[model samples]
Target: MRYFLKRFGFMALTVFAVCALTFFLMNAIPGGTAELILKHTFVGLEESATEEQLNQISSRYNLDDPLYIQFFRWVKAAVTGEGIGTSYVFRKPVLYLLALRLPATIQLAGASMAIAVLAGVSLGIYSALRENRISDHILRVATLFGVSMPCFWVALLLILVFSLKLKLVPVAGYGSLENLFLPAAALSLHSMAAVMRVTRTSMLETLGQEYIRFAKAKGLPLRKIISRHALKNAMLPVVTVIGFQMGNLLGGTIVIEKIFAWPGIGSLLVDSISARDLPVVQGCVLAIVSMFLLVNFLVDMLYTHLDPRIRYG
Candidate 1:
């Protein structure tokens, strides 16, 4: 309980800091969300972008308030679930915009992580069982390639092969399983590489342990020994890799979403930043931070289950 509480406290503090930093950084820019929205993003409103109108819009949200005051006000509003304010660019409730796009982001990130774990973990086990063989070396080289290549390039390459050449999936846009395949696979490749390497190394070490050698000397079937001893014990570090990579997958979607034209929070965030849509940016960031923290917390909880020796205070 103490450990859980302590971590929870830190996560809370980090969230508040993220909120404060995002809020201040957005306001520190020369123009306000209202001004930018009126002048740039919502250019259609430019005709009516009078000084009085701008001030009224700003005051309506109390944007003119001192930074501290505004920050506290936002915190209150967020805690109570009243509202997170509205987006200047979309002219919709910030939470509403998040709601609209969150599912797509979840779908993309979830799919990516799934691919990472399924392929990476399996391949990791396979490679470890065949360590020092030509196939193992080949997989290690491919893993390095996957880890080294940038996501955008991978995304484009997948698009070129699947979308452009084979026409097997979408070139861009989101919705349906078909639209998800390329982006999710592209996003997964890096994480998959990372998880695979960690799993292979961990499994290799675990297999070299005295108990593993003892089991081998006994009449225990190789498959049973692997399933019961090797894979289970080797999962600790792989779990950590999956947890951190889940967060990365969420954040990485910003670039991938734009490339694929997927209407997720990441793409929304990028567009909001471009338009100086402060409220939307803050709200989007807060959501992302919350998700990242949540995944870490869950992974910590999972440690107790994966390893009987792990105990929390």
Candidate 2:
């Protein structure tokens, strides 16, 4: 209970800090909040809007209040579930926009994470079993290549090969599974590489353990020894890597989303940033942070199950 409480408290604090920083930074930018809101609200309105109109709009939105007061007001409303506020660009509730886009983001993240975990763990196990052989060496080189490649470059190259030349997938825009392959593959590459490397290292270390030798000497079949003993024991580090990669994939999907037009929260975040839509930006950040925290919390629980020594207390 104490450990969980402490972690939950930290997550709350992190969320508050992110919200404050996001709000302050958004306001501190060159454009005025009132002007941006009014301009976006009324299509034809521009910098030339009269002072009287500005005051009215500011007063209506409580934007004319002192900075600290505005912050507190927004925070209170947000915490109480009244809402963070409307988008400065879309003139709609920020949550509404997020709700619409969240599923698409979930789809991409899920697909990419599935790919990373499945292929990464498989490759890692194979490499460890073959330790120092030609296949292992080749796998290591591929892992290095994945880790070194920039995401955008990977995305572009995949598009060129699969979408443009091979006609195997769509270059951009989202709809069906065919539309998702190139982007998900691009997004999973780095994570898959990280997982593969970690798993290989962890599995190798576990396989080298004295207990592994005992299991082998006890007349256990090679398959049973590897599966029931080696892989199970080796999973702790791999779990940690997967947990971290899951959070990263959720946030990092922004680039892939933008490139593929996947309409995920990451793409929404980028659009909100470009438009200076602070509410939307804040909402997106809050959502991402919440997701990451949730994943870590689950991973923490998983630790106790994976390793009996990891007690909550």
Candidate 3:
């Protein structure tokens, strides 16, 4: 309970700080959402609209208000479940636009993380068990390659080979399970590499401990000793890495999303940024930050259960 409380308190403070910073940063950027809207809406009416007409549009969106007042209004609307106002670019409710696009992003992130955890852990354990063997050497080389490759380049290569030359998957735009494999594979590669390294390191250290030797001395089966004892201890650091990677997966999806035409939050952010859609940008940032913080908190709680020595300070 004490650990949970402390973590929750710290996360709350961090969320508040991030929210403030996001708000101020958005405000600091020159030109209001209203101006952006007018630029798009009144493309040929620059000379036709009177100064008063332009001021009216700005006032209608409350863009003329002080920055702090605008922020408070946005917060109030957000808290009261009034939605994320309207986007200057799309001319639709920001929340509605996000709702339309968020699932694709969530699917991408979830699939990537799942692949990373499973593949990474398996490779890590395999490498550890066969330490210094050819298999271990090959796995290490593969992991290093995965870690070294840039996500954009990987994405492009996958597109060029699988989608273009081989025709194994669709080239771009997401739909159905078939669309997920390539982007998920691209997103998970680096995370999988990191997990493999961590798992190998942890397992090696755990294998050296006296308890593992004791289990072996008892004539326990290799599988039982490794599964029940060695792997369990090695999982602590793996869990930490997995949790952090979940957050990274969300943020890192932007480039992959764009490349694949996946309609995830990262892509939405890019689109919103290009159009200067403040509400959409703000809402997406807040949502991503909240998710990142929530995952971290859950991982911290899991640490205590996974390892007895991990006590809350």
Candidate 4:
């Protein structure tokens, strides 16, 4: 309980710092949503609109306030559950935009991580078991390629080979299992490579331990010895990597999401930035930071379960 509480306190502090930084950075930008809106709205009517009309519009949006005051008002609305107001570009509520896009992003991130964990662990185990063999050599080379490949290039290659050439999967858009495979594969490749290396190294170290040798000396079957003794210990490091990679997967889905035209938070973020929509950008950044922190907390809790040495205070 003490450990959990301490971590929770730290998380709260981290979140407040992130929020403050985000607010200040957004304000520090050259212009704001109000300025953009005013430019577009008063394009031809600059002479017709009286000073009162301009002041009314600016006051209505609270654009006339100081930067600190504006930030505090936004913070108040966010905490009070009063919605983050409409986007200056889209003219829709920020909360509404998030509600529509967040699920897709979550789904993409979850599927990518799941695939990376399963495939990477399996291959890593196989390579470790067959160390110095042809299979290990092949896997090592493949993992190197994966690690070296840029995600955007991988995404484009997959699009060309799978979507364009083979016509095996849909080229773009979200929804349906068929549409998910390429993007998920692209997202998982680099993570899978890291997992493979971690698993192989851990397994090699675990297999050389005295306990493993003793298990083998008991005339236990190779499968039983490896599964019951070696694999479990080897998995500790792999679990740690997976936990860290899950956070990366969430943040790094931007390229894959954009390539596939998936309606995820990454795509929304890109669009918001292009349109200079401050509220939407702030909300998206906050959501991502919160999710990443939550994931790390869960991963820490999981460590205690996965390894007996990781006891909570």
Candidate 5:
């Protein structure tokens, strides 16, 4: 309980700091903040939105107020769930726009993580059992390739082979399960390699332990020994990596979404930034930060279940 409370408090503080930083940084762009916002909001208007319109926007959002006051006001509005202000570009409620795009992002991230864990853990166990053999070396090389390549390149390569050459899946766009395959594979490759390496190293170490040797001496089945002893112990570090990678998946989705035209929060954030839609950008950053913090907290809670020796005091 104590640890949970402490973590919760820290998460709140982190969210506040992140939101404040994003807000201020956007306001500090080279051009005058008000002028840039006005230009983007009224690109269709003659003379970059008249002074009368600029005054209306500023007064309405209290943009002319000191930075601290503006920050607090926006924070209050956000917390109360009343509204997070309208988007300068979309002319829709920031929260509403986020709500629409969030599910797509969640779906993509969840699929990618699932692929990473299932494939990575299985391969890791296989490689560990083989150790220095030909198969193990091959997998190690493949993992190096996975980790060394950038995600955008991975994404394009997947598209080239799976989509363009084989016609196995659509080139891009999202709706059905087919649309998910390429992006998820692209997004997951790096994490999968990471998990595989960690799992293999941990498994090898665990297999060399006294308990494992004793279990072998007792004529225990190799399968039983591995399943009951080695795999469980090896999983601790793997779980930690998975938790950290889940947060990273969110950041990765930005590029993946844009490349695939997936219409997730990443694309929304990109568009908002380009248009100087401060409210939408702030809301997206807040949502991403909050989600990342919550995932880490949940992962911490999961430690007690994965290892009996862990205690959160």
Candidate 6:
């Protein structure tokens, strides 16, 4: 209970810090917020926004308030569910825009995470069991390739191969499961490689332990020894890598989402930034931070389950 309370308090502080930094840094951007909002909001119009219009926007959003005042106001609003404010570009509530996009982002993150864990762990086990054989060498090379390549480059490569040459999936855009493949693959490759390396290393070490040798000498079935003994112990480090990667995938999907034209928070954030949509930008940052923090917290709690020795105070 004490550990939980401490972590929960720390999480709250982190969220507040992230929001405060985002708010102040956003304000520090060059030019007037209202002017930028007006410029983008009425783009392609022959006439620019007049002084009166800019003033009205400023007043309506409390843009003229002192910096700290605006920050506190936003915090209050956020707690009340409308805290992120309205989008200057879309002219809608920021929360509403996020709500529309969150499901897609969650789906992408979840799919990518699933693929990384399943493929990485399976291949990792196979490679470890094989040791110095050709299959293990090949998997090692593949992991190197996965880890070395940039996600955007991987995304383009996947598109070129799967979407263009083979027509296995669409070039971009989202809807069907097929649409998810390229982006998820691109986003997950590095994480998969990382998990593979960690799992392989951990599994190798666990397999060499005295208990493993004893179990084998006692005529324990290979599958039972590996699954019930080796795998469980090896999984501690693997779980740590997985937890970190999951949080990273959630935030890193921004690039993948934009590349694939997925209507997720990543693409929304990119558009919002390009348009200088302050409210949307702030809201997106908040959402991403909250998610990342929440994932880390859950992973910490999960430690107790994975290892009996891991006890919280």
1-313 per-residue lDDT for model 4 (tens digits): 8887888899888877887788778667786455555555556753365666667757877877888898888888987999876787667899999999999999988888888989999899999999999999999999999889988899999999999999999899888999999999999999999999999999999999999899988999999988889888888889888878876787678777888999999989887776667788888887888888887777777777767987988
Error of 3 at 161 (Å): 0.8
lDDT of 1 by residue, 220-263 (tens): 99999999978888999999989999877887899999999999
Steric collisions counted per model: 0, 0, 1, 0, 0, 2
RMSD of 5: 1.7
By summed lDDT, which 10 consecutive residues of candidate 1 come out lowest? 34-43
lDDT of each: 0.89, 0.88, 0.86, 0.84, 0.89, 0.88
Q: Model 5: per-residue lDDT, tens digit, 1-313?
A: 8887887888889998998899999888876555666777665664656688778878866778998888888889888988987887777999899999999999999999999999999999999999999999999999999888889999999999999999999999989999999999999999999999999999999999999999999999999999998998899999899989987788899999999999899999998888788899998998888888877788777788879999988
Instruction: Extract clashing residue pairs from model 5.
Output: none
TM-score per candidate, chains pooled: 0.94, 0.94, 0.92, 0.90, 0.95, 0.95
Off by over 4 Å in 5: 43-49
Of candidates 6 and 5, the better by lDDT: 5
On lDDT, who's better, 2 or 6?
6
lDDT of 6 by residue, 1-313 (tens): 9988998899889988988898788788888888877778775643667889889989988889999998888789888876579888888999899999999999999888899999999899999999999999999999999889988899999999998999988999889999988899999999999999999999999999999999999999999999988998898888889888976797678899999999999999999887778779888888888888887777777778878999999
What lDDT tens digits, residue by residue, belong to model 3 across residues 1-313? 7767877888778876777787788778886556666766777864466677779888878878888998888878877899867887778988888788888888898899889999999999999999999999999999999989998899999989998999988988778888998999999999999999999999999999999999999999989988999987899999999888887788779889998888888998988877777788887887788888877778877888889888887
* Higher-lDDT candidate of 4 and 5: 5
